[model samples]
Target chain A: MAASTIMKKTGAALVAPVGWLAALIDPPLRALQKATGLNGMAAFFLAPNMAIFGIFVLFPLVINFAYSMTGGSALFLSGRTYVGAEQYERLLTCENYLDKRSCVEDLFWNAAGNTALFVLFQVALMTVVAMITALILNRELRARGFWRAVFFFPVLLSPVVVGLIWRWILQRQGLLNYLLHQFGIDQVLWLTDRFWAFAAAIMVSVWAHMGFYALILLAGLQAIPKDLYEAAEMDGTRPARVFWRITLPLLMPNLIVVIVLALIRAVQIFDEVYVLTGGGPGTSTMFLTQYIYEIGFAQLIRNPGLAAAASILMGAVLVVLTLLQLAASRRNQNAGAAK
Target chain B: MGRITLDHIAKAYGSVEVLNDINLKIDDGELVVFVGPSGCGKSTLLRLIAGLDQPTAGDIRIDGAIVNRVPAADRGLAMVFQSYALYPHMTVRRNMAFGLENSHMPRKEIEARITEAARMLEIEAYLDRRPGQLSGGQRQRVAIGRAIVRNPTAFLLDEPLSNLDAELRVTMRAELASLHARLKTTMIYVTHDQVEAMTLADRIVVLRGGRIEQVDTPLNLFNKPENLFVAGFIGAPNMNFFPGQVEETLPDGLSVSFLDGQKTPVKAATNSGAAMGAVTLGVRPQHLHLAQDGEPQIPVQVRLVEALGAETVVHATASGGERVLAVLPGQPAIAKGDRIALSYRRDLLHAFDGDGMRLAGN
Candidate 1:
């Protein structure tokens, strides 16, 4: 067959099933809509989407919870022995919550502590950097597109690749060390020291995600009407005053989103840091996911139950953070909607 | 102290020029309105005066001091935006105080000014509420209050009443007129609505295609537009145009022939150079009357009749497929497809030269 004929045949074949499905599915929907005198058409439209969400999201959530409840080496829930709250108790067994050395699962608690520190530093630093970068980029700058692409490029990289790339740059004989050497400085251990490795991990994590948050913040900045700024300018408002009184307040909702997302992703971080630091330099930079990985699949006998419990706790933390953000966002929206 | 002068001001964005060689002087305590259709650079001209946008090639002076290099913040001018542009998060009190605070005014004085302006605008009840909490009219008042509190040399308003409902707009328009009268600050208002311009302006500057078409008082603009654009733009029901050429330059006036073969000897005072050329004769809808037996007659085919209570605006067609609108007093006995004869005085007719500039004399 000629190319055009083949294309026509392919297009027809692709469209035929969709047409058949529509023909078969539409009548009952219309009938139901008329019979019910309610929003039956909306329900009909939503059914397929809901089913996909349920099968993927809801199904996995249930399985994960089930796994957390069972004390199991087995993958299947039916094959595992049920131990209600036992795994959770084991994970939470600590003389003092803040003291990771006192915990029964010392590595898990250590990872938990490190994750907290990582989140605090990451969220705060990322927000400030992203905000400043967004503001600078939002201006009529030279090579704006190129600068935006440069910032966003790291976000497009896989976490493992990001770790690998940073690992190369932060090694003792890396590009950073070479630059330092050019300044006649001694070679300092970057990844092999406890403090430097942890700091490097945090810095690398921030660099990788700064672009994403900046993009979000940039959108929020752009959404502000130019006339408000003009009005402020005409009102004889200083630049700083305009930002504090208008730009920052209006950007609160988008900022809250960046903060919450950065916190959640910081808690769940494993891949890049694992590849970069190996949760090493004496487990200084190990996080919750790394702890879970070590428990379930790596160094020790597979403790899937404990790992699942730890992960569930992590999920709960994220949920709480999200709820707080949602509340803050709702309040800001209410205030914003009044205007 | 608010006398603003634009000296050969021009603005362009790369190759696209928006305002060109604009020169105008706004006297102190005068409310000059820049009225035109959208994209006529009215707002751009206002921005230039306010020092929000720099003119690409000229000087802007306020109070006889050159302020071309001055930033908008230091220009000491206040502008009320079309959007109100209230700080969405700040209460009305803080919003009005923000500019004063930036100027480092004493807190007591700021409070006093805010209180006085709020009372003046009758918006003291809404001081604690954000702009979002107020109704549209109330928000508009707050916006005006913000400007009033500044007590600057000049006030630039960019269609401040364009957002309100029609009835509210009328009320706000009255308030604005009274406010301008009381304050007597040099105000330059920009609007696309000619009615707002006519009703509010001491002088209306009509602009088209990045150039000022005419500048005159409301009465003068209505009675004598300097060009065809102004004539058509200034009135509600646009002036009727009959395309014709000057047939003779008589000692008294001029003789013109309409395209549809109707010849009328214009009995105006004296003809100028612009009188002898291809011309367009403009008669406002209100000026045309139902012809009596002896007067000059215009044969028209009535197409539409709109009975607007006290008056009926009849949409009709004249010879050569030209559209004619006649706003006659009272509900006339007019209907669709009615052939009628109309008459207009030669003195009421506006004759434009080939270049669209209004010819000298009546």
Candidate 2:
């Protein structure tokens, strides 16, 4: 019996290795087994990623949609009253709560206009400055690495830190005023004035985000073959013409990516506006995200349904814009490839 | 219609010198080719002449003007790169007109030049197509057409045919030769292939280790190579060398005794100051022949015979432990380990001294 047990154990060890060897020799059968085994294996491998995505992305999105149609305290998960589409209707139609005056202007529409203006100015300014900086850096210059580090350092700073730093710099009695004092100029209230506050916010956004776009543009510039420039040189083509005819066209695909990413990030402007003005010295810096926060958490009367509805509407707009940009990019890539 | 001159051109990057004192004058409408191994600075020299690079010391004159500080665009020259370097985004018409457009040439003149260049290159049908839509040879033709449209004083080509297949390279080589004949412009071509240099060059400049080895016509480079490096590099199945010593100085020639103690008369002038101790006898493979009985012959043990239809190459070892190759007409039936008598014409022999310098006179 002992001898038989030893033989059985040895056979068991040989079987495990032989099975592995057989799997390698016969790929089709092994693939079938792998396909059959994927549910268990995938669950083991992807459980953590799925859990994080579900908690952070899918769960929040579903909860927001559900909460938009219900009337409840965000703190109290249970005992919620279903209000159907009333929250959406109130969000779109109710102007009394939106504006305190007898004036017929809607606060949601105003906030959206502000967000649109902010996105337009910030994205355009950032893209142009970044591309120009990248072009300058791509040239044969002294201390290129040092310049790249200087430009890219701002991208590493947190958005809140950037906002706080710029707030102090732009304040009436702060660094700008100090510099102006040396130059014998008058002090200006940068944050209190609506135009100045908007301009300052846009400038700070461009400053913080310009480095990332510049780095991407720099990569694109570097990818252009040196021989192309040499060929241009041999052709008697001027430097300006080379930039227009070769460099700019070749850098289009990268520029599109930078513009799209900047647009998306710019539309989601929240932290800077929050830290800089807390939605204002008046309503000058009250952006869409701050509006949502105010309705949901900070208002005298907490309107969960209105805030949820606002959040859903904003999310839909963002999704549509992103998809439109992606589709345009895809078409451009196809056209480029076809050529 | 311009002659280019490079007067003592040298290039150095930091401490390491890449090109050292290169001096050559290319005559008007002549095709000069720079041929060398990789990293031999042949391309660097071409770039210097094309004004793509500035020399660290020396001047490059085009049409009697020093273009040392001139940019490549203002130098009145066009270059075709190895990669063709055509704009992938533009149609052929646009690519050819790009330089003219940059110069602010009028629309009508640009179109006229483009049409003329396209017709000359036989690429009229491909004018509307982008470079990516063309074949390798077609793209090469377009690159040439782009240069042709400019009507530059000189043309610079850097291994333009190296990217093509063997058959295409030959076809393009003939095309390039015809192009040069028709254009009649000073063209400096750079290549590492000796066959390309031999077929295309009016005068070939052979470079080695950042220095010029020899500058000569193709036949001259083949027949009268100045040094051991040029002799070995320029020919197929290179010249063979056998070790020998001067036996005695004759009235008309020198009698050299081979390693096997056989004495043969070599018609080479001996330097009076040179020692007659050791020498090397060089002979081309085609000069060696199979000998009959009662002729001056050297016995060889045939190791391998290669039949190449037109000519047979016999690889053998001589009795004195010297390896030799003999090229004979047609196929010769010979097997390994067979003893054969190889003979050669006495006057065809070339004698070199110990330092690889060719002996004078005959």
Candidate 3:
């Protein structure tokens, strides 16, 4: 009892300075609150974050839009001429829209076609694979934690590291071909063939980031109550029917999130694929972001104007896709409520 | 055809056992309730019968066939979960029609059953609404309707009314009893509340620590509990137990003595083997009253008195430091800290041995 009393005294002594410090600042804070009502105080506290966002994000976005409308290869605004929509017109000019070779900006058209195909295949594959992985991991298995860690470990690896590791494994004299040679098979130019290289890019991208998407899907799957499944079981629902009717409908929201995020990320594919293929096999694997980088910085006599216009066009597509998805999700919600 | 039987049912997770040697039988159209405190394996036993779980060892027969290896769906038993478990995304109509659809019933038949069930439960107005849009009671009705549409041989309800508010629970309890009477399907219900068990059950199985204490009609379990646990668990405010010793075995009954050396002849049906030994005398509060002139009495100091308008319940301490409660009829003048003498008829007292088993009596 005496020791507890002494401890209590010590605790009070330790808290004394914090109380004094609060007293010192309390009046000024009260005055500030009085000067600015609640909403104004909220804005006051948000000012620093807003300033940082304005400088880093909004400012660059505005400059990029300005660059898209201008002419010349100058990096600074003062040196460029306002040529107003010429870049966009140049991008849109095409003899036969289906054939990239017929477009004036054939490289841009080629990259756009490649990105469209990549996003279609990559997003579908990523969502399906992640959902399957999440379902398997959610089951009651031995060393479940260890298996989950093994699946999620790749998500922690740097994209560059992922690219390098796959490159080593898929190169001509790499582990895959070496092992094939040990079985008396001829070596294949895995990264040089156009179809194989494109396939490799999609496969590697899925492998590199699927764990994160799977983790999101796993959280969704877990949020579904266990008793619902039991109820379905008692209802004598066939396994496939239950998946199609119950699991799929309940999992729709998370599936939409995964698809949209994967779609956006697939369009912005640069670093890993760039490291792996260098947009090679004669530009077969080139995508929109890589095309922008090449025009903005990589090529001799770089054209920042064209690159900025292409990026803004890509951003427009993304915004439209996001709005469409948001509307779709909203319709689903309203339908659910009405039902 | 829902007569069900469990022979030597036992369940354990790894080595830690939850139930042991549970045997029970239910008639074709009777409503049996499993009532016990939590962790007494009531829910586990229900799940075993439902085929949601495989027992560690047992033979479960539905009708006359051993269904130990049958799947839950094949067992033809529909369960109403405590959570109500209606698919949140499905409308009430679809929720009820899901099982019928799975059975490949014709579309017209499915709609007919759903309409009938919705009309029966008075949930027709909400059939187009999803579970999320309905109130708690409505959701519960939808859950029951889902079970009813299946036309299963037996209905397994696991604490189905436990999630409702008190007033709603009482109302729903009456509805369930009436529904059972109308349908006449064998039903096995699980709950920890003895009142629900007593009100709804054709027979109540009282359990403790996963072992069956007594299985009898509601009033029988109340009037003649086989063990001390059942007696204490089955009633409101609990039966009051006072320590005593058996003085002698009379031809009529056993003579028991309290700490004050006052002899009370209890008219119980016991053999001559009820010789001199320690005993616990249990008397329900309702059986006790203020002592009349020149009768055997227990002197107590009233610690508290709850004078509910219908009855007066006095909580007091006996002279021997044992807590005693007496429920007297109607409003009577009583106050806290008042000295009072209570009395009871000898036949109303229950005696138990040291092992917590009720001494043989009617």
lDDT of 1 by residue, B106-132 (tens): 999999999999999999999999887
What stretches of model 3 exceed 4 Å from their correct place?
Answer: A1-34, A324-339, B268-274, B360-362
Model 3 sits at a Cα RMSD from the real structure of 2.6
A82-165, model 1: which lDDT tens digit per residue? 899999998889998878788888888888889999999888999999999999999999999999999999999999999999
lDDT leaderboard ranking: 3, 1, 2
Which candidate leads the pack in DockQ?
A: 1
lDDT tens digits, residue span A58-129, model 2: 999998888888886654546667899987876566435545342232556666668889999999999999
Q: B320 in model 2: Cα distance from truth in Å?
A: 7.6
DockQ of predicted candidate 2: 0.55
| Model 3 lDDT per residue over A164-264, tens place | 99899999889999999999999888799999999999999999989999998898899788898999999899989888898888888878878887887
Model 2 has an lDDT value of: 0.85
TM-score of candidate 3 chain A against the true chain A: 0.90
Candidate 3: pairs in clash: A339-B130
Which whole-number lDDT from 0 to 100 does residue B178 have in model 3?
A: 97
* Candidate No. with top lDDT: 3
- Model 3: lDDT to the true structure: 0.90
Write candidate 2's Cα lDDT for B164-232 as tens digits: 999999999999999999989889999999999999999999998788989999988877777777777
Q: What is candidate 2's CAPRI-style docking category based on DockQ?
A: medium
